[model samples]
Target chain A: MSTEHPEEGRVVRFPTGGVSGEVDIGQLFDAHAAYLVRVCIRLTGSRAAAEDIVQEVFVTAHRRRGDLIPDSNLRTWLYRVAVNLVRHHHRSSGRFNRFVDRYKVDPREAPAGPDVDVERVERAHLVRDCVAELSEKQREVFVLYELEGISGQEISEVLGIKLNTVWSRLRLARKAFRVEWQRRHGEGDHP
Target chain B: MSGPRRLMDDPDFRWETDCDLGDEAILHEGLELGALKERVLAAIEAPPVPPEPTSTASTLGASGAAVKGALGVGLAVVAALGVGYMLGAAQPLSSEGVAEPEAVIEQVVSVPDARLPVAAPRVPAVSAPEAHSTEVVEPVASPQPLHRAPAAVEGGASEPVRPAAAAEVAAVVMPVQSEAPGTAEAPVGESGTVVAEVAAPGGVDAVDGSRLDVEMEVYDTAVQAMASGDYAGAVPAFRSYLRQFPGGHLSTEAELSLLECLFEAGSFAEAEAQASRLLQAPGFGGRERELSLVRAESLILLDRCSEALAIVDALGERDSRTAAVRRECKRRR
Candidate 1:
């Protein structure tokens, strides 16, 4: 009964094959892929993993376009999918996921340039590394709340946790980040 | 307080204490997301077989062995069979009316998040010239076959296309016999027809598992379907879950999820009714705001802009997203 191909521009072939209908996922990709990549890179602490998660998010979105709330915020839906993917990636990796989170440094941070001020670069690296060091749950809560500009309630919905839990984790994550920042750059100075 | 902004209202406090934890400037420090956009986009255009890439880090951690090992086979088999079955089954049913339309509600998240939305069984609506609709397709079928192809049915697949989950699929594969009331022993009859069917008129298909609380599995599948963007699959599945366990702990969650599924499925009329019911329900605790948002959306879509505006106005402090939707609805009005 449905006939509108709003995404007539980009056709996403179902993994199961046969020339099916086209979704505007390509437009979604154009609009938000990079934003998602930033969120993924921040959450996972590694570019490779971030890239992997971004791909999975899109593919999942493509797979579940029907469930998408029409005329709703597509960005919110996409963010929810990305958050779930990151959590799943973590859950499946089990301990390895933790290990990757604990020791892994993001590949995106650049080495200090000859002309660049070394102090700011070190401080930034220290800050970034400290961010990567927060426990997975805390890190996730922190990034969504602070970095992604998502609210605690929405974070709760997307992450499927209690609002109190999100607040608690965020509170702890802030303390941990503070401590780590101080530990790295001894006293008074802050980014 | 406003939802997202209330958390860190003071910019100075965040900058002084949190110290740019979520700074966008940091995102592009040593990276160029623009360069990889084309490659990433290309990959999305034609993604590989494995939905999640198994990373080297997975093998290193003490906790991941069981999880990684379990997910690889679990997701592959579940996705292959559960999704594949629905995909092949959804097509003909669209024109054929082989399955109940409301059955599709999202279930569990695949990534242990268990975000449930059945990868709903949907046939892409074939277009006739006059009426135009943007009915999204749920790619329920996987390219690979984890199990034998479902028995052929009229129009196409012979099996009644009920969106099922990996766990439910496994339960159906391994049936347990018990007199327990909720036991979903695959409705066996004179012909040995094992296709997953809703034995009752109200869309309640009990699982073939031995557990007394098979509702969880049903609930899980519905959530999965909902999560999979198969709102068509999610609606009925959520409906069934609500029916099977009206007083069950997850009932409230199921109701809200059903609202979302109906709204997303573009069943504005049903969504409006469901949202009204939810508004009247007794124990709607923390879910009123979310439900109100759904009600607003449904009203807007039904061309009841005034009613929708009233709902949004009552919220007073509307979230940015909802506020935008309100503005659009008014413009249309």
Candidate 2:
């Protein structure tokens, strides 16, 4: 029998002879799924592919239950796996642009309500487009640093690049992105 | 520049900052950044399904049962096992020996000259004029003696005579190898014998030559040039690689890299041609699609929106990379 714990909503299960074992796959999924989807979407720039990748990550984890590290951070592990899968996917396809093109969603039509911030939405789209224009390495670094807000060390771990390389890529990405924004908006406009 | 430096010199740069974009714009940017982060995080997390117990139980049960069954069978079949093992071991070797020559011949036909090792006997397989197209293998039976002639005809010989010599070799050897037992003697022609003798030395030298490593080295050099924004320097390296290893395993990569080089060098037409060649190849299944997308983007950059959109439309939404590139192409259009 499985019962929910009040604090974390974790499932507690009791079996024969007072022996107890519990697995909280639901909680794990809820906490991590959204974040995983977002990372994949940003990397691939396709919501559908992101959804597919996220489903694959969970499926893979479910298959290798026994190999799960006892003390390891599951979220971080999942992210690492997702990153690797994306890299493998890119290598096999040899067509990053095509993958992005096939799965990208058009920006939703702007709503008419007063609360619907058109400028913000437009800015978001512009940023996404600008980021997409970056070199693969630059975009990765920018997403990890500015968007995900991950520390340089964590980005290094996720990307498997050296810490120095991560910093360099981040610097270059930021500079290039800023330059792009400036060019698009013209001389007087600054962000 | 001095004013900007002075602004940076302020001790409380963050607190004292006064950007041209107003507070609302800054807040909006922050919100946008947050939303993007949330999306990214959501993409990385795993799914909600609990691991299935049925698969694990079945696998374990089957393996356990197999071990027990094997132990019981071992006790009953101890007398006959030795003969069975001997036959099993010898079967693979016999089959492998029979298959070796055909494998070598196929390899000679498929791989490019630059990728072939120095020790590889040059069998004149049919060379397609266009590097990426399929080679037309002549029939193995009607040994056309004329095809065996050297690629370069003697000075006085007409262009017609050269093709005749090539045709003779193709006709003679193709039939002999096709009909005879796999281990039959090498064909009598000079090129055929050379290739056959090369196959006889176990063909380890060809594998050991490390063609991929050489290509990788050249690729790395070209990438370095691109990284430094020296598009002109990158062009020659990529072109050299493509020329040398036309049908090399990394040919797709070289083709794509060459397109990038040409684009960066502002040779838009050349880049388009390379991209067109890539799309024409049948094996450009996966990452090759991305090459086409990039090529389209280059076209967009060149203000060739109609052509770019056409390329985008051709790439149906099978993959995200293509979809993203398509979106960009459409936007530009």
Best by DockQ: 2
- List the TM values for chain B, per candidate: 0.40, 0.37
Deviation from native of the Cα of residue B130 in model 2, angstroms: 16
C-alpha DockQ for predicted model 2: 0.09
What would the per-residue lDDT of candidate 1 be over residues A22-97, giving only the tens digit for each residue?
Answer: 4455555666787788788778765656666676566556555555444444565567667655654443333222
lDDT of 2 by residue, B243-321 (tens): 4334442343444445655754667677777667656654343224445665675676566767777776775322333
Candidate 2's C-alpha lDDT? 0.42
Q: Rate the local accuracy (lDDT) of all candidates.
A: 0.48, 0.42
Looking at model 1, how many pairs of residues clash?
59
For model 1, what is the error of residue A71's alpha carbon versus the real structure, in angstroms, after optimal superposition? 2.6
User: What is the TM-score of each predicted model, taking all chains together?
Assistant: 0.40, 0.40
Candidate 1 residue spans exceeding 4 A from truth: A1-23, A94-108, A111-117, A188-191, B3-24, B27-31, B44-333
lDDT of 2 at B250: 34
Tell me the lDDT of candidate 1.
0.48
Residue-by-residue lDDT tens digits, candidate 2, A15-104: 212333444445445656777777776676655556555655554454444455454545556666676555434432333343334445
